[model samples]
Target: MKITLEKVHGSMNTFYMVDGEERDDYANLALQLCAKDQGVDGLLVILPSNSAHAKMRVFNRDGSEASMCGNGLRCVARYVCEKEGVDEAVIETMKADLAVRREETLMDGIETYSVQISPVSFQLKDLPMEYDNQTTLIQQAIPEISEEIMFSAVAVPNPHLIGIVPEEIQKSPEHQKKWAEKFNGQNNYFSDGVNVSYVTKVGQGIFVRTYERGVGFTNACGTAMTASALISCMSDMVPFGEVAVYNPGGMVKCTVNKSGDTFELLLTGNATRLSVHEFQWEEEQVDSEFTAFEILDEQRQYEKFIEEISVVVEQFAKRKE
Candidate 1:
């Protein structure tokens, strides 16, 4: 069998997207393609959908399926848009049917996409967190991690535990990794585990580092950033507006709307189609290595886009200073 796949990234969180109609061994394929050596966060299998534009199925590097992925959605939207030549789409995930739009170009070569991450929830049952006597988990201290560190749990159909850390902690890469590791799955607080983000407020923006539940530390975790921004707004850490979210990979802008208990989030960022890999496989050979795959590089253009944005962000930071 011959398989063609697109490798794309949003805010540096990358995935290998393949059509579901082409193959049936997605779980094993995801594990193989998303290996650290392969340099991908996960694999997304795009399936046919009757309820929406298309169905998006996400698999972590560890081959665990996730309910939703904000970053992956942007890439999928871009894929569908470029493939179908449409400006808008509604992609179905396991959790919800998300609305996505191809926004104006952010850079000369990079296309920007905006995705609606909706149906936000803070209830314990939605996150399915093992907690008692609490309907909502908000800035609560889990003694298992520390006596001082407080966490806010929210699910944008994906479970996230966010901690507002000090500037110094967020600034130090070592500290960020340590804390991410501490609470990720090592801690006994969350039984099913959660994507953990350590966020720090910087000027009018915020910097985040996430230890994803199944993927561990990534360049960026879109839903984690959305969850971070939403919690920051709810906690009065950042006012409602265009929230610039800086992750280790790059930055993404999030527009948050909160009316009493209702919350809606819009995430806008680069949807970069880095390359395409074409390979030949046999159905019986699950772990077959593809030594003869073709690589089409779009990474150079993406790097240029990154460079343009980095300069802008630097100047903005300087102005703040």
Candidate 2:
């Protein structure tokens, strides 16, 4: 396992990318390094590109495969920008065109990298929730759950719910576990599956903690942020426009709008680099190093690039204000 590693920083978070199938094993080492230094916030393992196809899978330090990751994108973007010496770059994923840009960090000793997420769309049919075409008001309470949470399924590529809980509910271990269980199960709202997000507001910004489907509880989820923000706007919790989302891990800003018959979302967050290490493995006669590729046309990539840049400009403008 000849593995290469890169250190990239986003916001205040640092991540390590292991270019080999032994990502989980490497990620554990990275986590230990972060613990030793006491600065690393998250760990992501990007699987090596396959021979026949180029694709990557992500895993958090806890050895969980996240359905979607926003912060990790910035770390990868930094790798491309610094290694390739290009301010603007595109990372092809299995799902969407991740248009990335190098940005100045607001906080000292931190680097800011931004990546635009796939546009958001809400279709119960598309999400494949339990609800049918006619069911509009889903006020059903999940069985064996006490939070009285309501769920709305949205896809930025994963199923998620915008669980609205009262502010008075103290965030105890009991409370967190209670909601997490309900979100993971196939309740009356979503039979196929669902990721549960518990939301609250701190000042003008909205904060969330996600119980992801593929992965358990996590500090932040980019897709969940977009879905929760959209649900907030639709429920009039927050006005339509750009929304500031605070997750347990950190903050990610989301923008949403209506397009034709669906809602679109743009999720922005920071990423960072952790460490680089070589895998202790022998060389292959036919292989050089682990590689991955994504198939995206130039036109689509350029369009996404422009859109993401525009969002970065918006963030800069907000700073000016």
Identify the candidate with maximal TM-score: 1
Lowest lDDT sum, 10 consecutive residues, model 2, at 312-321
- Top candidate (lDDT): 1
lDDT by residue (tens digit), candidate 1, 1-321: 678888888978888888766455787778767542357889988999989989999999888889988888998998888788899999998988999999986666678899999778888778767665788889988665556667888888888888888865665557545655665555545656788888888778887788888887787888999999988887799998679887767788899997777888999988888777775545444545555445656657767766655643343222110
lDDT of 1 at 19: 78
Q: Evaluate model 2: give its lDDT.
A: 0.56
TM-score per prediction, in order, is 0.89, 0.67
Model 1 vs. true fold: TM? 0.89
What TM-score does structure 2 among the candidates reach? 0.67
Q: What lDDT would each prediction earn against the true structure?
A: 0.79, 0.56
lDDT of 2 by residue, 1-321 (tens): 445656544323345565445432544454443443344434555443433122345554444454456666666666667766888776656466667777665343345566666745466655556554533323344444553765565666666666666665425335655656764564665665566777766567677667666445655566677778888877778887788876655566777777666666666655444445543333332333324323323223322433443443232112100
